[model samples]
Target: LIVCTHDLAVTLTQRPHHLIEYLARMKKRVTFLHLRHLYEQPRDKGSPYIRKKVKIGGVEVRAIFAPFPSPLLNIFRGLCVLLHVLLFDKHRYRVGINQGDPWIGFVFYILRAIGVIERYVYEDLDYNPGGHKNWLFKRITEIAEYYSIKVSDLVICVSLNLLRLRNRWRINRVIYSPNGVHLSLFSRAIKKKAHPPTILYIGSITEYFGLDIAISVLPSLLKKIPEIRLIIAGSGYYLDDLKRIINKYPEIKGHIIFLGRIPHEKIPDLMAESDIGLAIFPPSELMHYACPIKIFEYMAAGLSIITTRGTEAARILKKYSVGLIINYSVENLKEAILKLFMDGCLYKRFSMNSLKFSVKHDWNKIFHDEFKEIESLYLEYVLIHKRTVS
Candidate 1:
């Protein structure tokens, strides 16, 4: 059982897709129940939304998201969370909260009231949304983090940096499960290329992702290679900033395009239309811990990648010999893109190597591995519960 604040069907994040796909494949042996705030919750409805709780293509599945309420209407959401736990057989269900917000305390309070969910898992996806330097939010976050770590049976963090907090709470089951991509989807994208020499960038244009780097480099790149076109496939708080940057560069004014937000399934088509993928996250302490899913998607599409150094994605590229890793300078990026076009053998090698490497790390296969471990843990939990009850 998975209990989260975000609607699985309406909002598409990596976590929802991972949970939905995993449960769908293992439904015969595993029952899944996804809980969310509500289906009507206002969402970006663009690149941010991945999948929904609704059945896809008439497939009836148990991993469904139940919408509760927004904070304003969540005065009694605790009871709702409790009622769902009571509705399910305790021994057959495992509870997990996708987002570790302070309000989740209300959900767990309901779970504790019913004595149905024995173990709770908290997933920490981000360290801070706004700057961590804000005193009030920082204090609130610290307190919330403390409480979550103290109560949770397991804390599944996406980065190793989060693991540093494990010692403070005496938690032993902390695990690192980085974001991943669907390799099969990318393969199809590469196979069906609609645009030649296309350049694509998908994901947040936030201060962290450094879409500005691409915006700065693109004009010069276009000057060198007039046929080049760019596709910016995601949106965030920094979209306006990125637009300003792009507009400042007259050479790339008409060559660059923004697709706004797109569906996860639609990404492959967009990737297929591009020959090169860009991931130019800025140089910051925050970036050192990032594991961008776009790199894998780029590799799967067989596109030569241009990205910054000091990221897990760069390490993977280096290890697999799939793409070029470079610094975050605009001059370096421009030079790299030019080299990718001029050096045919290197680009071909990177493209072929990327396609081969991406197959090994597809989310479909990764989901199986994670689900198997979760199932084992669930069974172990049941055995311990029975022993205590007996």
Candidate 2:
């Protein structure tokens, strides 16, 4: 069973899509419980439970939806889960995978204590203890995180830096599983037109993502390369602020285009049409340890990457010669963009290297390797438990 914070129907990005698709392909029996808050009130006000049967990769999957707005809703959802476990799960479930949701982890811990679940895995993709604006809320969530980490049989993290928490948390088993991309989907031939060179920025439009810096450097870039254009995709809380900043610079407005939140399927085509990919993130603890999915997707699409320094993705770029890393400043970014645009050989080399590096980091390979480790650990635990019982 996989429990996550987003509904699979609304968005299939990040952890939810990757794990569900991989499990379906492996022909494993998987049930996904989506505990997401609905923007509008659910139609069934009496019963805020919704169920769906969906198919991914031709494999049938059971999806359950529950409202997760408050503590009361979470308690109700826990009861729903307990009922499902007792009535439907006749064969005891061997593993439960919870995606950093403390409430879900608490419920699974209860199930494990009752012998319904043998063990549970905690997947932590992001380590943002101080991300919430509400200090009380942040502290509560952090406590929940600690509890989840303590109770989990196996902890899976997307960054190696997170392994440092093993010693701090007294955890025995931790695995580093970085983000990956679907190579085949992004294997379209790069466009070979003599039009204006396009620099593309995809994913969320948040302040920390450094899209504002990209916008700030565009005026300087336009002067050097008159035909260069900037394309910004995706939407977030900072979208209006970004638009306001752009409005201040009417001269470069024609050179910049904003494509609000794009569908996941259309990203590949958009990448293929562009010359460069921007993976800039602000210099912060959270970003320094992050394995951004956009970086891998850019590589798979064969775009030369321009990213901020000190990130895990930047380390991979440096090791593989797949992209250029610059200081998180407007001047440095402007200089790097101009250098890449002016030098044809350097751009070609990085573009080719990006594609070559992506072959090793495909989603298929990363998940297969992690799954093997998980199985081995489970088997070892079973053997030890039997010996102890005897």
lDDT for each candidate structure: 0.66, 0.76
- Highest lDDT against the true fold, candidate: 2
lDDT (10s digit) by residue, model 1, range 262-286: 8788888777678788877777655
Clashes of 2: 0
Q: lDDT tens string, model 2, 1-390?
A: 666665554442676677777887887776666654546432222221234655565444554446655643654655555566677667566777787666566778988898777788888777655355566766776776788788888888887766676557888778888889888777863554455789999886788789888888888887888888989887667989888889888878899989876667778888867888998888776687677898889988888999888777788789889778999999999888888988999999999998888988889888898888878877887999899999
Q: What is the C-alpha RMSD of each candidate to the true structure, in Å?
A: 4.6, 4.0
Candidate 2 local accuracy as lDDT?
0.76
Task: Predict model 1's lDDT versus the native.
Answer: 0.66
